[model samples]
Target: MPKKKKITPNPSGSQLHAQRISELMLEKKALDIKIIDVRNITTLTDFFVICTSESEPQSRAITDHVNLTMKTEGHASWHTEGYQYLDWVLVDFVNIVVHIFSKTAREYYEFERLWADGTITEVQDEV
Candidate 1:
């Protein structure tokens, strides 16, 4: 039997990084931005930024905007996944995990329900 790998929490830049990701998502007009504080629930990641783009193109745009903006602002993701499908894109920045999903896919995943125990904060979109 293979041993399961444990995910260590990265305390450095957790909040700041998550905040920046959320801000970028908002700037890109990602709808219903949500910040989930899963620090107490899981050690894998401190925070989860879940937001929905109107369509696949917008989903890609949101992810791209986040990547470019964060990198330009002196932060870069350690790993990114799900770009091929463009339905759900994940940008992992160690402590902060950003999820840019299409409307239908976002509803299907129901990440908010999966992490219901965690503190879920709704990020208001200015526009």
Candidate 2:
């Protein structure tokens, strides 16, 4: 078997963006917000912030909140996807990627399983 590559610590920018995204998700009442460092497994994105909203509307709201908050805070996304369906919304901030999904959709995709090797950090929202 080929040797496994080492996972580098997340860069400052990636961590900052991940925190910001997590905060926004919390503000929107997103459930189970998690930050996964996938830099070691794939270079496609440095970090992934996954969260689930209760419904389609909530999912859209969560994504919108993150996008608006980030832009207002002077951090704009490089691109965004899956807004039309509202089942899952992906906001790409270059270093950090935000995924806002409905509960069912989140379970179906199972991104956690796909990136099981990455370091998963649970982010809780203080009520």
Q: Which residues of candidate 2, in runs, are more than 4 Å off?
A: 1-11
CA lDDT for candidate 2: 0.88
How do the residues 1-127 of candidate 2 rate in per-residue lDDT, one tens digit apiece?
Answer: 9999999976588788898889888887889899999888888888999998898888888888888888998998888999999888989987888888888888999989989999999998777
Question: What TM-score goes with each of the models?
Answer: 0.86, 0.87
Instruction: Mark the regions of model 1 whose C-alpha exceeds 4 Å error after superposition.
Output: 1-12
Clashing pairs in 1: none
Instruction: Report backbone clashes per prediction.
Output: 0, 0
**Error of model 2, residue 29, in angstroms:** 0.4
User: Each prediction's Cα lDDT score?
Assistant: 0.87, 0.88
Candidate 2 local lDDT, residue 7: 92
Best by lDDT: 2
- Candidate 1 local lDDT, 1-127, one digit each (tens): 9999999976457777787788888887889998898999899999999998898888888888999988898887889999999988999987889988888998898989999999998988665
